[model samples]
Each structure stands twice: as structure tokens, then as C-alpha cells.
Target: MPNNMTAVFLPGNKQVDVRAVLVPEPGPDEVLVEIKASCICRSDLSLYYGNAVISGGDSNQFVCGHEPAGTVVKVGEAVTEFAEGDNVAVYLAVGCGVCHHCRVGIHYLCAKWKCLGFTMDGGNAEFLRVPARNLLKTPKGMSHLAAAISTDAFGTLFSACRKVGVNGLSTIGIWGLGPMGAAGTLAAKAMGGRVVALDPIAERREFAESLGADLVLDPTAPNALDQVREFSGGEGLSGAIDCSGQTAAHNMALDAAAPMARIALVGENRETTIKTSDHMIRKQLTVFGSWYFSIDEYADILALIKSHKIDLERLATHTFDLKEAETAFRMFDNRETEKAVFVR
Candidate 1:
């Protein structure tokens, strides 16, 4: 392995450059991974566009791109589970395992939660160091590109569906038709739920239909809520998920949900707001803000993938070389690709 490597860094607004940096060494409980593939997530765009509040404040530039899959090159002294040459997928959310939340398997809610590529130096490079506890064993036959999406997109959807109690017969409504939304549709179908997807983009809606949505409705349509209600036999949806991160879409989700239904808010939106009383008490709705998945949940997701229950490969639309990182981010920013990846 080289002593140093080239990594993509985002210094500031619209400032992306490649530079040589020292390759990180593994700590006692961490492992150094030779990254094979990393996916471009919407959160990465937030850092590129200066929308996310990264660690070290807004002025301190950092490396980005978190969903990474690679081979373990070096293991820490205390790392007994993994060794060199082991193929793995890394969970981006890093937390101290001894913390209250971490002990209970709620790592995402850890007070010291620091996500890779967001609060720390991430996998937009040839190599990176990560906690051994966050590494997941990739399925034998899965490609690195597909495994990369499993870490974030598919994992997040799996967590959301669990939060909403999806059981094949539930009438579910999904707001947003992006990769996460589309993945949720598949998850709902896998659970035997009847899905109704809503999105303004014709292509995204069409994609949802292809994934087994009973109906696809335009969010901007005058009778969008009515359309969903009609599909649910006038009782409203059993549950809803707002993955678009739009305030309007959130309102629509609440409107479409049945009484006492649960709604998982998975996306990030700064300007979105909701009326607390009317949206909560009037409907007796349960709102859950899902971040990343728990370690136990992630393990279950991996097992499902290995069993051919989760089709993660369908979400990746494009793949690029690490040298073409700029092109990949550009395409992702413009919404030109469903999921873009950087293959090493």
C-alpha cells in the first residue's frame, strides 16, 4: 500500500479539488480500508452546495462521499472479527460504542454521532480508516457498487419501513421518488403492502409504478390526497413516508395518512414546517425522524440481501472511476442519475 493517496476535497462553495494527503493509519479498534466503491448520496451534495453544517464549522473544508465498500487492508490490534483482504461495507455513522444510545443499538441517536464524509474525512479517496464495529460483511456474490448503496439508501429505507410497521396488507403512501423513495416502494412491496407513490417528475413516478406501486399520483395534482384516499377505500393510508424533504410534501403525507397512522420523516429539509396540533392530535399520527440504521438492523438487511430478498442492484444507475469524481457529483446534482458511484 502507498504511504499517501489522492483524495477529493470540498474546500468551500463549489470548491472541489483533488489533493495528495497522508493515508490514515488504523487505530486500536479501527481498520484501514482500501475503498473499492463509494456512492454519491444527496447529503454529499448538501456539503458540496454548502447546505449542511459540517464539523469544524462551515469554513473548515473537508473530504466528502460516505457510502463506501472496500476490502480491509489493515486491522487494529483489538479487531478480532476482521482481517486483511476481507471484503466489507462500512456504516457511515460513527459513534462511541459505550455511549447510552450505542449500548441500546440506537447508534444513530448517539449524542456524539459523527457521520463519515459529513463530520469527518470520508471515503472519496483511495483509502480511509473506520471503526471495526461499523463494518458489515458484504454478501459473497454482490458487486461493490451494489453493496455501497446498501449502506445508506437501502439501509435507510429498511429502517423507515420498520418504523412504519409495514405488513404486506397495509396501504402505504410514499412521498418522493428518489432512490430512497423507490427503495422504500420495493421494501413495502416485499412486506406485502399496497403502495401509492407521489412525485412531480414523470420519470420518477413511472419508476415507482415499475417497482409495484398500485398507483402513482402527481403531488401537484389538485386531488392528490383524494387519489390516495380513494385507493385506500376512503379510509386514508395506513402509513406514509415523506422522503422528499419538502414542506409541502410533508403536509401532503400527513393529509394522506389514516388516523393513528405512523409517518417516517427520512429526508432533510430546513424550510419544511408543520402545524403541530392539527397534524398530530387531529389525526393521532405518530411521526418518527429516522436517521441511519442500527447495527442489528443493518445486519438483518445484509442477511435479507444475501437471501435475495432486497434487490439493491436496481438502484444504481451509473458508475464512474474515482478520477471522474467531479463528473459523478455534477450528474448527481443535476438529478440526471438515480444513483452514481465511484469505482476504484
Candidate 2:
């Protein structure tokens, strides 16, 4: 193993810094992974813009690339479940193991939650040290790029779709056609839901269509909701997901959903307003926010991936070497790519 490695850091003002840093050593309950693929996420943009959504630490000081997958190269003495040569992808949330949330494998909800790439040294580098419990075993033949994206982009949506009970009979509306929305489309379709996707951008709408969306519409159009109703045969959508994190999209999702339908808010919007009795009480709609998945749910997620033969690499519109961190971040920030990854 090399004594040093290259890692990327975002120091605000849309700046990216690639630096040579010492390779990290794993602690007693951790394993050191030789990173093969790391994906850039939309959430990382906040740190790039000099303001981070999650506070309590200097995000710039940590290596930044959370959605990562690779091979375990070294293990700490206390690490028993994983060893050298095992292929794995990391779950980003690190929490106090004894907490109620962590006990249930919903570590992100723990009071002492610390996230990879935000509060800790993450996988932007060639190597990353993470707790053994956070390591997800990758199935055979799963490409490194696919493994990386499956950890966050695909996995998050998978959990959300599961929560909303998407199935063969569902006609779901998805707002926003970014990687998250794309994942929602894939997950919804895999479970037999007819997806009606919406996006203002022509290319994103087209991308959603190419991903097997039953219908794609421009949300800004004069009668976008009308199109949704028409597509749903006047019954209205059975479920909806808003990945845009925009207030307008949230409102549209509620406005277009059928009575008794469920809505999962998977986006990272700071605030939004909704008509209480009109959108929820009257319609008897169920709405809830979903973040990452439980560790135990990975088995179901992997089974779905295998049975559906999901091609995660299709979402990766661009790939770059670690040295191209600047260009990669800039292009991703500018919305020029559908999905981008850093590969060894």
C-alpha cells in the first residue's frame, strides 16, 4: 500500500482542492478500504458553495466523497465480519451504536450522528476507514461504479419507494429528473409502478423517459397537473415523490396525488408551505420524509438489484480520475452531467 494518497476537499466559493495526504489507518472496529469508485452527490454542492446544510464541523477539512465502493485491503484487529479482499460499499452515516436509532439500523436519526464526507474523512481519497457495521457487501459482477452509486443514489430511493408501498398497481408521479429522480424511476419501475415523471428541463425529462418512465412532462407547462390526471385515467396518481426539494414541486406533488395516496419527500428542502386540510386532511394523504436505508434492508435491496438486473452505470453520465476533481465538481455543480464518478 502507498504511504500517501490523493484526496479532494471543497473549501467553499465553488472551489475544489486535490491534495496528497497520508493514508488513514483503521481503528479497532474499522476496516481500511482501497477505494475503486466514488460518486459525487448533489448534497455536496452546499459545501462547494461555502455553506453546508449540516453544521457542527468544518466540512472543508474532511475528505469529501461519501458514495463509495471498493475492496477491503486492511482490517483492524477487532474487525471480524470483513477481511482483506472483500468487496464492499460504505453506508455514509456513522452513529453512536448504543442509541435507539442506531440499534434499529437507522443511524442517520441518532442524536450523535456523524456523516462520512461531512463530519469525517470520507472516500474522495484512495483509501477510507469506516466501521465494519457500515460496510455493505457487494454482489458478484457488480461493477465498482455501480456499487458506489447503489450505496446512496439508488439505495436512498429504494428505501423511499419501499416506504410508500410502490407496486405493480401503482401509478406514481416523480418530480425532478436528477440522479435521485432517475433512481426513483428505476426503483418504481422495478417494483412494477407506472412512473409519470416531471421536469422543466427537456433533457432531464427525456432522460427519465429513456429510463422507462411511462410519461414525462414539463412541470412548468400550463396544464402539467392536467396531463398527470389524464395519464392516470382521471383517478390521479397513487403515489408521488419530490426529489427536486423545491416548494413548487412539493405543492405540485400534493395537488396531483389521488385521495388516500402516499407521498415520500426524499429531497433536502429547508422549508416549504402546504395547505393542511386541503392537501392532507381532505384527501387523507400520507406524507413523510425518508433518508437513507436501514443496514438490514441491504439484503432486500441487493435482491431487487439482482432480480431486476438494474444497470446502475447507465446513470453515470461521466467518469473522471481523482486528479480531475476540479473539472468534475464544476461540471456537476453546473448540472452538465446526469451522474459523475471518480474511479481509480
Candidate 3:
């Protein structure tokens, strides 16, 4: 193993730093992962502009990628279930093990949690050191790139689709065609829901159509909601997922939802206005927010991927070596690519 490795950092203000740093060593319960693939997420842009959304936005000094997959090269003395040579995807949160949230496998909700790539060093490097509890085993045949994307891109939406109860009878309208939205489209379809994917960007809409969405439309079109209704046979959407985080998309989802519809808000947005009486109370809607999948859900998630023959790698339109971090971030920020990744 190399004594030193190249790591990427987002020093705020659209800066990308590829620095040489010592490879981290595993602690008593930690594992050292030789990162093979690390994905760039839209949330990373918050750090790019110096206003981080996670870890309280107080720091951007650590390595900067949360979705990473690789082979475990070293395990601490306390590690048992996972050993060197195991393939795994890292869970971003590190919580005190004894906490109720950690016990329930929702580490991100732990009060004193440390987020990888936000508060601590992350996997945008040749190696990553993390607590063994945060390791998610990757099954055989799942490529490093797919495993990486599976963490955030697909896993999140998969969880969201489950939350909204996507099924054969579902007429789900997905707002946004970014990686998350695109992943949601696939998840809904795989779950047997007919999907209507909406995004203003023509390329993104086209990509969603290629992903097997029943229909795709420009969200900005004057008759966009009409198109969604038509796709749903004028019954309105049985379920709706908002991955755009835009106020317009949020309201649109509510407006297009059928009576007794289920809605999953998967995107991160500061604020959005909703009509209470009309969009909620009278309609008896079911709405909830889904962040990431529970650690235990990975088994079913992997099964769904394999059973449905989902090619998660198709979501990554661009890949780069760590040295090309700047170009990768630039193109991603400009929406020039979907699911750009950093490869070792």
C-alpha cells in the first residue's frame, strides 16, 4: 500500500483541491477502504459554493465525496464480520453506537453523528478510513461504480418509492430528472408503477424517457399538469415524488396528486408553500419525506436491482480520475452531466 495518496477537497467557492495526504489508518473499530469509485452529488455543490448544507455548514476542510464504493484493504482489530478484500459502500453517517438511532440503524438521526465528507475525511481519495458499523457490504457482481451510485442515487429514491407505495396500480409522477429523479423513475417502474417524469431540461427529460418512464414532459410547459393527468388516464397521480426541491415542483406534485394520493418529498429545499385546505385536508393525502435507506434495507434494495436487472451504471454519464476533479465538478455544477464520478 502507498504511504501517501491523492485526495480531493472542496475548499469552498467552487475550488477543487487535489492534495497529497497520508493514507489513513484504521482505528480500533475502523476499516480502511481503497476507494474504487466516488460519486459527485448535487448536494456537493453546496460545499462548492462555501455554503454546505450538511454538518452545519461550518466546515469544508475534509475530503469531499459521500457516495463511495471500494474494497476493504485493512480492518481494525475489533472488526469481525468484514475483513480485508471485502467489497463495500460506505454509509455517510457515524453515530455513537449506543444511541437509539444507531441501534435502530438510522445513524443519520443521531444527535452527535459525524458525517463523512462533511465533518470528516471522505472517499474522494485513494483510501477512506471509517467505522466498521458504517460499512455496507456490496454483493458479488455489483461493480464499484454501480455500488457507489447505488448508495445515494438509487438507494434514496428506492426508499422514497417504497415510502410512497409504488405498485402495479400506481400512477406516479416524478418531478425532476436529475440523478435522484431519474433513479426514482426507474424505481417506480421497477415496482410496476407507470411513471410520468417531468423536468424542464430537454436532455434530462429524454434521459428519463430512455429509463422507461411512461411519459416525460417539460415542467415549465403551460399544460404540464394536463399532460400528467392525461398520462394517468385523467385519474390524477396515485403517487408523486418531488426530487427537484423547487417550490414549483413541490406544488405541482400536490396539485397533480389524486384524492387519497401518496407523496414523497425526496429533495432538499429550505422552504415551500402548500395550500392546506385544497392540497391536503380535503384530499386526505399521505405525504412523507425519505432521506436515505435504512442499513437493513440494502438487502432488499440489492435484490430488487438484481431481480429487475437494473443497470445503475447507466446513470453515470461521466467519470474522472481524481486529478480531473475540477472538470468533473464544473460540468456537474453546470448540469452538463448526470451522476459524474471519480475513479481511482
Cα lDDT of model 2 by residue, 78-166, tens digit: 98989899999999999999989999999988999888898888898899999998999998899889999898899999999999899
- Pick the winner on TM-score between candidates 2 and 3: 2
**lDDT of all predictions:** 0.84, 0.92, 0.91
Task: Give the alpha carbon lDDT tens digit for every residue of 1-344 in model 1.
Answer: 89888788766576577778889999999999999988888877767777674454442355677899999999999999999988898888788789888987777677888778877878888998999998988867878877888878888888888889999669999999998899889878777789999999999999889888999999899988788889999988899988899999888888888899999998887667787888899989999887768877877787766665666777888888777777787888889998788887
Model 3 C-alpha lDDT per residue in residues 30-93, reported as the tens digit of each score: 9999999999999889889888888554445699999999999999999999999999999888
Regions more than 4 Å wrong, model 1: 53-61
* Winner by TM-score: 2
Ordered list by lDDT, greatest first: 2, 3, 1
Better of 1 and 2 by lDDT: 2
Tell me, by lDDT, which candidate is best: 2
lDDT of 2 at 159: 94
| Model 2: per-residue Cα lDDT at residue 214 | 95
lDDT, candidate 3, residue 77? Answer: 97
